[model samples]
Structure formats: C-alpha cells, structure tokens
Target chain A: MPLSTVLTLHATTDTTLPNTMGHLAHAAFLALLDAAAPEVAEAVHGKGENKPFAVSPLTVHREPCPVGREGDTRGASRTAGRGRSVHGSRFTVHDRAVALAAGQECRLRISFLDDALFRPFSEAILTLGQPTIRLGKAELLIARVTCVGSDEEPEARYETYEQLVNRLPCTVDRAPCTAYREPCDADAHSVHGSRSTVHEQLSFRFTSPTAFRVRMAGGERVNWPLPDPVRCVRSWVRRWNEFSGFPFEEDELCAKVEGGVGLARHDLRTRMLEFPRGRELGFVGEVDWHLTKHALADEPFLRQLHTLARFAFYCGTGIKTAMGMGTTVCRAP
Target chain B: MPLSTVLTLHATTDTTLPNTMGHLAHAAFLALLDAAAPEVAEAVHGKGENKPFAVSPLTVHREPCPVGREGDTRGASRTAGRGRSVHGSRFTVHDRAVALAAGQECRLRISFLDDALFRPFSEAILTLGQPTIRLGKAELLIARVTCVGSDEEPEARYETYEQLVNRLPCTVDRAPCTAYREPCDADAHSVHGSRSTVHEQLSFRFTSPTAFRVRMAGGERVNWPLPDPVRCVRSWVRRWNEFSGFPFEEDELCAKVEGGVGLARHDLRTRMLEFPRGRELGFVGEVDWHLTKHALADEPFLRQLHTLARFAFYCGTGIKTAMGMGTTVCRAP
Candidate 1:
C-alpha cells in the first residue's frame, strides 16, 4: 500500500486584475506548497548549490466570477482598468500523478482567507440590475484577456491568453464556499490565472514511484469491496449473536465488535509493541488483523485466535505501513 | 511580611436534612487549604503522601435541632433531660475554636454544598426563614454548608459511627457553594466518610518548615508582604502602568499590585536562579528592577517586559492570562 498525499489550494485577492495576477498568484501557490511540504519543495527545487527545486503538473482551476451590478459601472470600470480581477480558484495535486482509483472520489471545497474584498464586489454587482454571477459559483466573467480574435470573445488581446482560462482537464464541478458566510461558489479554473501570464511555476515529483502497492491476489487493496470494516464486523457479530441468543441490532453489534477490535488493536499497537527506533511497525499488523480477523471473527475460540493473528499481522505489516501503503505502487523500478 | 493565604471552601450534599445539615458541610473548609497552599499537604503528611495539610481554626458549626422533627425531639429531650447532650457537646469543640478566630475579626462564612440531601432542607429552611448566627460584625457565620442529613432519624443509635468529612483551617470567608457546580463541590470527605472515625489512626511525621526571608525595612510593608518574585514582578508592572500614565483606580491598582511582586519573586526564585547542584535559589533584588533587567529586557522590549511581568503575576495567582504563565512550582529548600 502507498501513503496518499492530499494537496489543497486557497486563493484570495484584494484587488481585481486580469491575467497579470497569475504571476503573483503562482508565487503564492509555490510558497504554500513549500510551507506545506518542504520535502516536496526540495525535490522540486533540486539539491545542487544555488539550484531551487522544481515543481511540475501544477494544476490550476478557475472558478466562476460573480456577477457585477449594472448601475455600478464604477466597479466594473475599476476591474476593467486595473486589468486584474479575482476569480477565486482551488487547485489540488495528489502526491501521485496516477489517475484516481475506481470508486475513489476526492471531495474539495474553496477556502478564502479574506472574504471582505469579494463582498463589496458581490454587493456592487447584486445591487445593480445585471446578471450577477452567484458569489461562489464559477460562471460569471467580469473580464477576460484573450487572443485578438478568439471564438469566445472575438476582440481579444494575446494569442495564448484564450487557452489559459479553459476548463480544467479533469473531472471538476462547483463547490460551495462554506467558510464564507456569503453564498459564494468555487470552480477549478479560478485557482490559476490565465496560463500565458505565468512565467515560472511549481510542480510535483514522486521520490519513489512504487512506494505503495495494492495487491488483489492477497486481498490487499485500497477502498476495495467498499472497505466498510463496520459492516464486516457487524456481519460477523450478527452470526455470533444469532447462535448465542444475544439480543443485538446490526448497529449495536457493529459498534461493539468494531469498537472492541479497534480498542484492542490500539492497545496492542501502542502498549504491547515497542520499537526502539520509534518506527510504527506494530500498527500495520494490528490494523491488518483487526480488519481481517478480529473484526470478522464470530466464534469465541476464533476471537482469541484473531487476537493472536492481529498481533502477527502487526509484525508483518509494520514495514509497509511505515513506508506508506496505498493503491498506487511507487517503486524505483 | 507573610504571604496572605485566602481560604475558600465549597461543599455539596444531598438536601433533605433540616438546618442541622451545616455541621457536616466540610468540603469548602478543606478546599480552602488546598487552594491557598497546596504545599501544605506535604507539611502535614510527609513528602509524597497525598493527605490534606492545613488545619482550620473554626470548629465545624451545627445548628440547634428544629422543633417537631424526629431527630430534634431526641436532641432537645437529651439536652433538657441530661442538662447537656453528646451531639451538642460534640459541636461545642467547633464553637470554642471558631470563637478565637471570630474574636480577632477574622472573615468567616459557611459554604453549603448543594446536594440532593441538602436541597429539600435548604428549601425548607430558606422558606421558613434564613438561619442567622452572628459572631460579631467582623466574624459572621455565612451559613456556607447547607446539605442533606441522612433520612434516618438524626438520633439513630450506632455501635460506632464514622464522621465522613474533611476540614481545613482558614481565615477567609468561604466561597458560595452554589457558585461551583456539582461533583466539583463534593470533596473526598463527602464522597468517602471521615477516615478517622472508621479506621485505626495512622500517624505520619510532618515536614520541617522551609524558611523564607522578607526584607521588610527596604520596601513598603503591604498586607502579607513577602519576597514573592511573582508578586514583585506584578507590582513592578503596576508601577510601570502608573509611570506610563494609565488611569488605574485605587481598588484596581491595589488588586493589581497586591500579589504581583510575590508571584514574580516566586517564579524567578524557582525557574531562573539555579545552582550547580541543581538546587534553585530565589531571585533577590527590587521587583521592578530585577524583572526589568533580566527577563523583560528581551525582544520587543516594552512588550516583552509587560509579558514577563504579566506571566509572573499569572503564575503567582494561578489564574489564566494572555501572558501564559500559570505553572506548577516545586523546589527543594
């Protein structure tokens, strides 16, 4: 199994600017990456003297611009004149570049540091009798910089500017900005400004491609068979309950068996197993046995057997868990 | 000058008994010593023993038996029958002890624990009329312990009865029992009956007093003035505020400066002053000057000074503050 890494991006701007904002936005994005993951920063920048790490596949999303007011031409004019507009965007780059595994979905939402700036603009547009874009929804276009004659906006500016604000190449949709009290929606493209404006960008790299492995032969997979440990434990406990005449509902059985296995495994992993190097080897076996044996054992004898099995599993999975286990296999090969 | 130690007690009991419940109200008294000088525990019950230390001068007060009550008839008949009763005699010890402190104008108050046993009793008493016991204007019985006595007749005979209460001696008014919620108001005494009545008394040697010196001549001798580095630092801060032209009223200034110097000195003594043998020495010097020179003169100069002084004050007071100072103090003197 591989350790999965999640990357989240939050963009905010006080003033409106066109594609020019992408340069600064990109810098901020890179800074966030460095702050969040210094090891990834080292890999991106490089280890040599004076050579900074390099970041790649820096995905950017442009959320819909909120609708502006009709009467308040001043706000629109200001945005038009400044040539910089805020199209709040969110970009996420998984640690691994591989496509998401089947049945695995990553849910993300927009997070804004300062919503005050966007509030005035939102209010200005709402007050005016104009098609105000929903605050958070990625649909309204306050300003667009494009090639001299693009299909979307015929009177454009630069050649590649038209290609910059295009839809992201991945499955994307609008998400609510719950952090903000106002009803603002977010889109993927809003994160990175027009691509033509960004000169230097950050990217990601896998230190080892085969660090995680998902093996189906041995029933080792990430999120396979729904991976509902509670269900598995409940089913096992229900079988025992029926035989023993113990009155218990599915939820109760699930809770008791799952909680018991979890608590026992946690105790064994934390208290019983001691690694001098401070490595978390014991947890791997504990988790494996807890999921496969302890949680699913019905017979009293089997329950005892499962405890020992969980202990052995802890020892076996120790190394893999420490290295990071996921569906994606990232190895030197 | 000695450090003025304020004793406050809070008690809770099941409310059912008549006004007679106050005698068993002992938690507030014990809590007073626990709050004022936790180190007193070591003094009374040798080092490492977990027994309460301080002894209160006030004898536990018990009200006269109410007329028409089952227990009252027995108590009143005995008092009239024998010219004196054992229960009444037992309470005489508390009255005599409290009389000494009362004569000295010491602050006193009864802290009644709000327990189920005391609820009905309190309600009935308050409904009928407030019980008043005046020991001079200076030393008034505040009626602190209003709890529930056993439902069994108060005069019920027992081969040997245990007094399930803990007591501490103090010179301050008890805190209102209602102010503290249940559970917290119940002390070990209320939870477990008095240890002395049930078990063979075990004797333990008390620790020797750790002498602390006070340079009274050099500085103003405020109430309970002692060389507490913490209070010293706090006083220095107040002096600084005054010098800085902050408008601090008399009560406010006194409250601020009262224990500040002692607290600062205490912290400096335990934390900053260290010897090669690992023995720590208390800081010596003017409160304002020492803190200003050593701890406060760091980054953000003035702010740092205020922070250190505030921290010392907080540590000494054992209260939470922005300075982040409250910490346990342990020293080998």
Candidate 2:
C-alpha cells in the first residue's frame, strides 16, 4: 500500500538552515535510498522516467526573516581557507539563516506511491543513526525521529477530502467511495432514469506559496497562477493514476468530470513572491468555489473526482510540490 | 496581569452549527458572565466604553459552503405552523450547515485585558453547567473544556517590563520557546560602544483570518490589509500600553523604535472572505520581515518593540482581535 509518513526532527543544537531546505531533503532521500536498497535507488534516480516517491519542502518550525535573505552564501560555496569569505553565484543562498534554538523541532512529510519502496526507505531511516543536516555553518543532528501518523487507504490519506464531502450528501463514510486499489463497483454506480444536476463545493487552502507553470505564446514555460479548477484537478488525477498502477478510465474521467464541471463561485487572492532565483507571483491564500454539473450521468465521475482530489493531498498539486511549493488542503461542501 | 489562556473543547457528538457561530459564543459569554458575576457583566456591557475582554470568532473545525447560503431555512428556522416555510432577510443563512463529526473538538480562546476580569471569567466558566450554545438549529454542549496552556505575566496580565526584555535575548528557552508568563533575563543585548545597526526578524502566523480597517482619503473607514512593520508594531504597542497600565516613556518608544525601524523583507497573501453578513477581504497567511535601526542608541527601543510584539500574542493585533479575527503566533530571529 502507498504510505504517507511525517518525520519530526528535534534539533540538538542552535542551527541555521538555508532557505531552500527542500534540496537538502532531496539529497537526504537519495543518500538514504543508496544505503537502503541500492537497486531501487538506481532504478528511481538513474533509469526511471517516472519516480514513484514524492518529498515535500521542509517546513521550518522557526520564525522567517523580515526581508528574505536571498543569494547563495552558505556552506554550498564555501572554500577551505580559514577565516576567509566565500562568495557564490546570484542564485546562491543569501547570508541569512532560519535559526532554531536547541531542542526546536521541525517537521517534514514524505509519501511513497509505490509500496515496494516504502518499507526499504523506512528501514533506511531507522538504520541511518543520527542523521545530521547541514545548515549554513551549523550542523544539526536529528535528536529523535518519530513517525507521528500514517494513512494506508486512498481516501484516509487525504483528510481534507473527507472534510469537504462531509458537508454535502455524499459524506466520505456514507457515500459510495472507492480507493485506487478497488475499482468502483457497478452497484455503487447505479444509474437513475432522469438527469439531475449535482453541486459540490471545493475549497483549497494553499498552505504554502503556490504557482503553476504555463506555456506562453513562444512555447517558453513561464510561472503562472492556477486559474482553472478543472485543469488543476485533471492534472492531479492524471499524475496519480499513472503512478498508482490503477486502471482508471482516464479518458472517461476527463470528459465526464472536466468537461462537465464549471466554476460556480470563487474568492482567490494573488501576490508577487520574491525568491532567491527570481520573482514569481504566487498565492498563499484560500480559494472556495463550487464544482457543478447539470447531468446525473456525471454522478459517478463526480465520485471519481472526489477520490482523485483526495489523492492530491498526498501527491500535492502543481509543479515543485516535491520542492514544497504546492501544499494544499482541499475541502468539500 | 494580562494572561492568554487556551481552552480546548472536545465534541462528544456530531454537531451542526450555523456559519456565524461567534454570535452564539457571544450569547454564551453573556450568560456565563451573569452566572459568575453580574456586576462584572453590567460594568462591561453598561459602563465601559471599551470592553476589557475580547472574544474571538469561532474557528470552525470544519469546511465551509461555496455558494452563499442565504435565508435561514435550516431545522432551526422551521415554523410551528404546519404549512408555513420560514424565510429570513437578504443574505439569509442559506439552507446549509457547518457540521462537526461526533468526537471532533473545536477550540475558542478568550483574552482579558483587565487582570481583575480574569478570575471572574474563569469563575463564570467554572460555574457554567452544561453550557449549551445555540447555533441556528443545533445546540452544542461543552463536553469538556480543558485549559491547555496560558501566558501570564507583565504581558498576559501586564505584570511588568522585565518579562518582555528578558525573553528576546533568552529566546524561548535554548532555541525552542514556549509562550507563557515566565520572564527570562539573560545577556543578549550587550551594548556595543561605537554606533552600529541592529536587525531583528519577526513573523506572525494568523491562526485565524485577520483584517484591519483603514480610513480612506474620503474619510470613510474601509477594511484594509496590514502594512509596514513599524506601523504594525506601533499600533500593537499603543493598544497594549494603554491596557498594561504600566507607566513607560511612550514618546521615546515611538521616536526611537518606530522612527528608526525599516522593513527589510515581507511575504504576505490575502483573499476575499465571505462571512454571514457579506464579502470582505482578509488574510490567512504567514508574514516575515526585519526591523532594522542604524544606531546602537535604538537598542533599548528595539527591546521595547520586541516586548510589545510579544504582548500581541495575548492581546492580538489590529481590530476585532478580541473577536477572533486577529489570532497570531509571533517568533523572532
């Protein structure tokens, strides 16, 4: 079964971690994979076109700097000359650190889409004895690593989905629901004679800064804000369906759900976010809108939509979800 | 002493509450006050120009509806007349409810600016027997109310200035800090002789949706987003200093800190929010920035800024802080 695990790390000393801690986590994952099951690691990092694992950006449990420290200047570009100043490229980390007092705990959550890799990766973490993360000049040890919670089934992994659907007639527990492993039974998809419309509310709480990449007229990819809910959901379900190895009627799902769904209401806010590399407008706010369709024939597709949206919780939404940009909490009404 | 207390309420049954539950809480507070201390209630409601206590907006532990629910048509609004359908005014509570599953809990935090009021409030809550809150049709009983934690000191109860100064340098205990009433005194701000600039970073996590009202050029007060670290800090201090009742050099504080401080960085996001009344823009985001001063003479003022900002934890920031819109978590770097 696919698994989602949260690792809580208590810093053993006062430490300064770089801004982009996601890169550090990626490195750690690679190293752990090399040690745990080298073949799996090689298959994932070396040969595979589609990776089965996803990592979220490290959420620092500390206060952020008022003026963000940009430009790389940490240990990444440091030379071995004692008492000498080392400079890095424009994209280098700026001379600022997210300070953690000794004993401060920071948390990171990771998900394994493929069951074959979950146990080995978890084992690697267990055997990695006192993993030390480097942050600028500080080397912080993971005083303790604890897996606080886990969810096995497709639905439970996305807590927000249940929260959403519960407000409507189709409650997560009461309604006809199925995980990726179990296909929807014909009985659950019982068709009624007359056509009827169904309306469901979807609220996305962008837990972190989020943006989408769009192709411009020149065919260059430019960072863009996510405007259409249908497209967002479609992309999310497509990615997970492939990795899940579950035979979802992808085309049918797209045509019925995507083509049928329309925005009923929305309240979204956007702003420009400055990063070390460049500037991109992102949203760190909440958006609530209704996903509505006029035909009862779309009911089964609606159920599928709910299931896939729940999956988005674990897989995350949009680009750089693994790098920690798109952390979303979806709710239904 | 200004004290901040958090009460965690665990639900015993699945409950459905109206969207605007703050009004329900308001009624409960009044009832509780009448039971605990009638004189305090009269003094607060009848005599005081500015109420000493502030109640937060209910942080519903559930999702919300998309299409605006107007007109109270829930079970609560049903008329006794067999054939009659009850209707409310424009923007009536639509025929929907915010539900809480059985065994799910919601938390509400109240703050008392007046130290004397604390005991009476606590006493009233203690005396309250089976506090049944009326939320439209649903009645939610406080299954269990536990005081999870509190911050009482020169801040919480306006005990003194030392608690504020000691905390900044001592820093929430070795890297991890707990917000409470304890005062920490340590060697952090050692005066460096020659003039030098000092920078401090501060961040606030809006535990609830928050917005501020600003007077436009037309002199009409309109809801506005919070701007400028200096103004934010200044307003925060001004409110608490009056509530604190501790005599301090207020003029010096403004000239030294507000005049000297400049914003080094910021990342803020805001969105339009829908309440029972109508639509208003609000922010549910994380803001980080630096307060910088060019001279050592401003160190004392910076210390004062830190102290007051910490006070904001209990007092909250901006308007309706007591009404639940301004709940914030503060941290320093």
Give the alpha-carbon lDDT of every model.
0.23, 0.48
Candidate 1: docking tier: incorrect
Please write out the lDDT profile of model 1 over residues A162-187, one tens digit for every residue: 12113122322223332111112234
Q: Write the per-residue lDDT of candidate 1 for residues B1-333, one digit (tens) a residue.
A: 001111211111111221111222233333333344445422422422111111112222233322212122233223234321123333212111121212111212221111222233334334434333322222232333312223421211111101100111111122222210011121212212222111101111101111122222223111111233334334334333332233234344334322121111110111111112222112111111111111112223323233323222112222111111121111100
Evaluated at residue B224, the lDDT of candidate 2 is 43
Model 1 residue runs over 4 Å out of place are A1-136, A140-333, B1-42, B45-140, B146-333
Q: Which candidate wins on lDDT?
A: 2
- C-alpha DockQ for predicted model 2: 0.01
Q: Given the true complex, what DockQ would model 1 score?
A: 0.00
DockQ of each: 0.00, 0.01
